[model samples]
Target chain A: MSAVAALSYLVASVLFMSGLKMLSSPKTARKGNISASLGMLIAIVVTLTDEKILDYTFILAGLLTGSAVGVWFALRVQMTAMPQLVGVLNGFGGGASALVAFAEYIRISGDASLSVWTGDAPLDVLITLVLSILIGTVTIVGSMIASAKLHGVMRSAPILYPFQKQTNAAILVAAIVLGVLFVFDPSRWYLLVIIAGLAAILGVTSVIPIGGADMPVVISLMNSYSGLAGAMTGFVLSNNVLIISGTLVGTSGIILTNIMCKAMNRSLANVLFAGVGAEYDPSVQAVEQRTVIRYTPEDAATILESAQSVIIVPGYGLAVAQAQHALQELVNILTAKGMLVRYAIHPVAGRMPGHMNVLLAEANAPYDILMEMDQINDDFQNTDVALVIGANDVVNPAARYKKDSPLYGMPILNVDHARTVMVCKRSLNPGFAGEDNELFYNEKTMMVFGDAKETVTKLVQLMKS
Target chain B: MTEGLMISIYIFVLAAFVGVEVISKVPPLLHTPLMSGSNAISGITLVGSLIAAGEGHGGLSVILGFIAVVLATVNVVGGFLVTDRMLKMFKKEPQKKDQRA
Candidate 1:
């Protein structure tokens, strides 16, 4: 039976691999997801039928209740709330790992007759158990804080004070000490609980110092931690399927974290600790009084009509204004008029990686016209009009040269290079990075002040007329 | 470490490399789905959760294992369903037959 179970797990792991491989392309992504779910189902069924099963009531109830809640969340979530949803699911994954490790500890410790550490061929199960609990507890707490920030339940600003770094270090040190003590003496199981407590505190301290703009990096890192926690649990239980899948998730998270960090031209450490956008720099003067031409929808429409090529750049404000559908309508009208139109997506354009793409896809925009930053950036120079809707920092030219600016050294859309730049924004305020956009004041730029949805809708209506 | 532990370590190292290689090629367009999908795979801890819960140690272990099973199930089920929902949104270009000429 164990052999059969092992073979089934091998099959399940293969399914997960192929599922992930298929996810690399849009045409097969949905099928890939389905394939992975089938793998999960197979693993679950085989595990249940294995000889370890002494009863089934608790397992049945848990499966039913969890499925109901999971379906509820998956069905009702808005596309705009995707980051929070993912964060919550990550928390659950980590919480499960911690709980499973804790249960294993209680099981072994309750039966005093069996000594786990005495054999010359030690499994190091105790050490893995401690690590699983530690990493998993941290992931749960960190993911909750991140989700709260994304959902606007908590202040999105970085919560910092004197000695914050030192305080976090102390908590981590305390957790490690407790973990070591538990590993050495299995009788000291209470120490494991304390270690989890310290780990939970460390989770809060580490995540609270990151501001909302850096959430993509924080979430990716937490996702990695969740996977590491699972891997740790796999070692505790001697489970290969868990280890392989967990390592895969851990690697994916690291890759994404690296990509997001590179896009902002910031290292992972700076994103995690520097708290870059904590507050507006007081030294930067209030340049709000600087004047710029504010164009109406009608004038913007006229300029857009004559443009040979246009690149649409979107940001979080597009989600806030719920203007993706309106913008897509406008794109259809423009495309029909024999004008070349495409979207320019900065890697960090929104709160999460690929956030703008999800919103645009939800609005029914075809995938071919959506262009990543590296792909569409150069085309902006030859383009007649660069229409920036609800985006600021990504299009700011200061990133290229303003050394004193927080956004400096970061890659930005070359919107300023277009023959004409049309910006539709609610106001002339600086963006989330607290850096003023000089592109708004450029002679070639025209600022259309209004809600993004209203402005884009008017443009669509005008184009239709 | 036991031979089993050593083998597990080897598998972990090799799988990590495979993950980086396989995931690196995923286009930015499908990143959200990629994230959610991999998240579901991490829920493989559900296997451990089942063993623990079904063992029915008749005490705190059962309670903890039950909760673990529920949470792991939510991670697996919710992650895949949400990934599918998001991927379903990514429609390909409408057939460009009108411009073929």
Candidate 2:
């Protein structure tokens, strides 16, 4: 039975690898998902029916109830809320890992005659058990907070209070002490509760102060922690497949986090730069404020008609107003008119990483036309019109020069450099960074203030006529 | 270390290397799905949850086990469903293969 289990696991792991590999490209992505799901199904069936099972009722009941909820969430959620959904679901994964590890230890403790139960846990089991509980609890708490922020239930800004840093420090010290105690005396079952409580609190407090602008990194980092938790749980269970797949996810998630951080040009030493924007710099005032120029959609159509090329810079507003279809239609009209149209996508463009791609793809926009920030940044200068759609901070020139601004030193698309800039936004409000964008005041930039979908729909109609 | 621990460690190191290598070139366009899909992979604890739920060692263990099972199932089922939904959203550029859900 063990040998068969190992074989089944090996087959599932291979499928998992291939499924993930296929996801790297858009064309094979759907098939990739099907492959991975099949792998999971096989693993579930094999494991549940194995000789270890004493009762099937709990597994089936849990499976039915959980699937009903999962399927409902998957089908009903708006694409704009995908990040929030992912955040909460990842929390569930972590919670499961922690609970399983805790329960396994409890079961072992129930019997004192067994050597493994009577004596201290071997070093490997002890370390992995602690790690699983700590990281898993953190993932659950941190992700719930993150989901709230993304869901707009909580303010997206960092929820900082006085003495936040010091209190967080105290919690860490307490949790670590409890962990050490658990290591020495395995039967102090109550200690698990205290340690878990501290760790969960640590997760919440740690993520609360990370501003909304940092959510992409936070989400990826949290994803990595969940994976790490799973890996640790694997050690507790001696399950090879869990170890393999969990490590894969853990490593990939961290790499994704690094990619996002680099895109924002952030480092571990970002605190030093936090004060860089505290003092109002003279350069911020240097921009000569011009009376805002608001253009009608008809006027935007006229400008776009004469342009040889156009680049659409999408932001969170695009998702908020569900404007991807209208934007795509406008693009089609321009494309038919022999104007070159491409989507200039920032890595962190929407609420989550790769948000714009999913939005545009849902609109049936061709995948080849969507260009990454690095790929399309240089082309903005040569483009006839850089159409800004509801994006604010990412296109702000302040990132390049206003060293004291929160958005300072971040990489932005050079949309301001384009020959003609058309900004389709709802208002003159500052973006996620909550600072005025100097780009709006530029001579070449014109604000067409309205709902993004409404404005884009108007543009599509005007251009078609 | 015992041979059991040694084998596990060996598997851990090699799998980490392979995992790193496997995810090397994921395009930026797939980051959301990548996050979602990895969340599902971490749901491998569903097996552990099953054992705990069936072990029925005590009342407290049974309750915790049931919840763990549900959570793991959600991670597995929900993650894949959402990921597939997102992946299916992409309208391919004149693909030779039929691209229907």
Candidate 3:
């Protein structure tokens, strides 16, 4: 039975790896998902077949309940709310691992007199169980808070109060002390409850001070926490397969998180210890802004026709308007007119990392045409025109020069450096962080105010004419 | 087989089945977030590894467990930090408004 289980796990792991690899590219991602799901199905069937359980009722009930809820969430949750839902699911995974460890510990404790059980139950098992519970509880609560913030049920800005940091420190100390006590007295079940409560509080407090803008990172962090808990539980059970899979997930998540952090030009310590994304008024004076160039669709088309090089920068507005395909069409037309067409993708342009890339890839935009911020920012200066569709903070020059701006020191698309710039947006409202964008009023920039898709569509038509 | 082993197998089966179904419905837009978020959940594996290390009475298991715990911790902490950093970019208002005019 163990042999069969091992084989099944091996197959599942292979499928998981392949699925993850396929996920890197959009074209094959769906097929990759299906393949992975099939592998999981096999794993499930094989594991169930090897089980000696006769009481299927409770197991079936659990399966049904979980599936029902999972299906409902998968279907009903909006794409915007998916991050929070993912957080909730991550918490559940941690909680489940913790519960499994607890149950195993309880069983071992119940049969202490049995030498066979005593032989199998090592001190390592007890340690793993406790650690899994503690970390699992923390992941659950922390992830829940992250979900709430993403869903807009809680504040997006860092929820900092006077002495909030001090209180968090105190809670950490208390939880650590409690964890030590639990390790010493495994028989005292109440210690487990206490540790769990303290850990949950720790998780919540850790994430509470993190601002909404930092949610993706927080969510990633929580994901790493849950993965570690799973691996620890696997260690307790001596489950090699679980350890391998858990480690893979844990490492990959960390790497991806690091990539994201680099894109934002922030240190990990600053993100974790400092109250990042806290709302503060900018000290920079609002320049008496003047639009030097306001172009109708026809005028923008005329400029595009004469341009030698054009760089298109996309933002969340593109996603909201579902304008990737339309933008792709526009890109094609410009390319045919002997203009050099490329996309300038800021690392943090949309709601998450690679957001603009994903949107563009979905539209079958050539990968070669999509340029990173660093790669294309310098070219913007030499380019004839920089066209921004629904992007804001990423194009703002304030990040480079204005220390008082909320986006100070952050990397931007350098669209302002272009010879000519065209911006398409619906309104003058501030972005997610509520900081004013300075690029909209630049001398070389042209404001083409409308819905991104509609405006791009009109521009495409004018260009065709 | 022992009832515990049987139950464990059953749990694994159920979890796998459910996990596949849930992941299938996830849209492309939510993929990165879900992946990052789920990675955090998976970091719970570290807690188990940490416990294993503390409980190990002798040399080999303890050493292995400790290494696993450290790696897992790195994964968790680094991953979260990176993720939060990435999210900071989205928090800023597009400064393009000034350039537009």
TM-score of each: 0.96, 0.93, 0.74
Q: Which of 1 and 3 is ahead in DockQ?
A: 1
Off by over 4 Å in 3: A22-32, A50-54, A75-78, A111-121, A282-298, A320-329, A332-340, A361-368, A378-382, A401-409, A426-438, A450-454, A457-461, B1-101
Collision pairs in model 2: A276-A404, A277-A404
lDDT of 2 by residue, A1-465 (tens): 478888998888888889889988988988888888888888888888788678778878999999998899889988888889989988999999999888877776756222344644686887788889988999999999989988889877666677877787899888878888888888776777788898899988887877766788778888888888988999988888888888888888888878777777777335212322223344543464546888898888888889999999999788889898778878888988999999999988876778778888877788889899889999988999999997888899999988887688889999988999999998776666666887888888888999999999999888888
User: Model 3 Cα displacement at A51 (Å)?
Assistant: 4.1
CAPRI band for model 3: incorrect
Window of ten residues with lowest summed lDDT in model 2 chain A: A271-280
Rank the candidate models, highest lDDT first: 1, 2, 3
lDDT of 3 by residue, A138-251 (tens): 888898898888777987788777887788788778867776775676666667667788888888888888876667677667666676677667766766545555555555
Instruction: Please tell me what DockQ candidate 3 reaches.
Output: 0.06
Error of 2 at A218 (Å): 1.5
Q: What C-alpha RMSD separates each model from the true structure?
A: 3.3, 3.5, 10.6
Instruction: Order the numbered candidates by DockQ, best leading.
Output: 1, 2, 3
DockQ value for model 1: 0.63
State how far residue A30 of model 1 sits from its true place (Å): 1.3
Per-residue lDDT tens digits for candidate 1, residues A187-285, read 777788898998899888899999998999988888888899999998988899999999999999999999999988899888888877787664564
